[model samples]
Target: MTAPADVPPEFLDRLRPICRELPESYEEPAWVGVRWRIRKRTFAHVLTVDPDHQMAYARAVATDEPTCVLTFRSPVDELHALVAGGHPFYKPGWGADVLGMVLGDGVDWAEIGELLTESYCLLAPKKLAAQVAGPAGLCC
Candidate 1:
């Protein structure tokens, strides 16, 4: 499928399905990148790579080259584990429960899908989450 002009094709290919499948999920422009929301609350967001921005918060994490980063809400333990896992994942200096991961080559799409599912569960209302979680409490 063709991606939106502003979104990376690879990102759309990998993440769109996961986000779209969840009930009450939608996407919108989030300043420089995009954000996926459930019940009007953002569960995942992405930012365009920008090394030279006036606001330090706007700059991407220190990297050798430009790289888009996908940030998502995560449980604290999971957040730390992702960081401990190595490159491609790190904590952005933002929300206490939010973590950032560089999106590029070698990314583990399956793991990312799991994280997104978890984030959706966290933000989605209990009833909606239960519906998405299916019979075994696994993501749909």
Candidate 2:
């Protein structure tokens, strides 16, 4: 299947390697769009239903919501723009990828390891989040 124009292949490949696999036996609703819920609430964004685009994004909240998604935050937009040559647009689950690139910066792979660890702190079930982390970018 063809991927949406807004998505990059490397980007999708990078993300699918990190997130939970889409359930093959499950079905999706019409026009509701593909969505991935981060931390179950803080973020929710649409994805392309086409099999090729392994991406996701957050549901945009009211502008005044302080707890709005970080992906929507200016820094993320600006950083992504400079880094990926795009605007605030995201392809879901890509945050984990960025967190790795952002934290690594050539000198520290371990820092990326830490950010991935903390990501689950704000993302996983309390019980799982409490367990000591095993590895970052390791099949989630």
Q: Which candidate is the best by TM-score?
A: 1
In candidate 1, what are the lDDT values of residues 56-116, reduced to their tens digit?
A: 4334367633467788898998889988887777877778888888777787888888888
Going through the candidates in the order shown, the clash numbers are 0, 7
Evaluate residue 130 in candidate 2 and report its C-alpha lDDT on the 0 to 100 scale.
49
Q: What is the TM-score of candidate 2?
A: 0.32
Q: Which ten residues in a row have the lowest lDDT in candidate 2?
A: 64-73
Q: Against the true structure, candidate 1 has what lDDT?
A: 0.76
Model 1: how far residue 118 lies from native, Å: 0.4
Residues forming the 10-long window of minimal summed lDDT in candidate 1: 51-60
Question: Candidate 1 — which residues are off by over 4 angstroms?
Answer: 1-6, 54-60, 134-140
Q: lDDT tens string, model 2, 8-98?
A: 3443334332333322112222233332344343222223333233223222221221111122112344335544642222323444333
Tell me how far the alpha carbon of residue 12 in candidate 1 is from the true structure, in angstroms, after superposition. Answer: 1.5
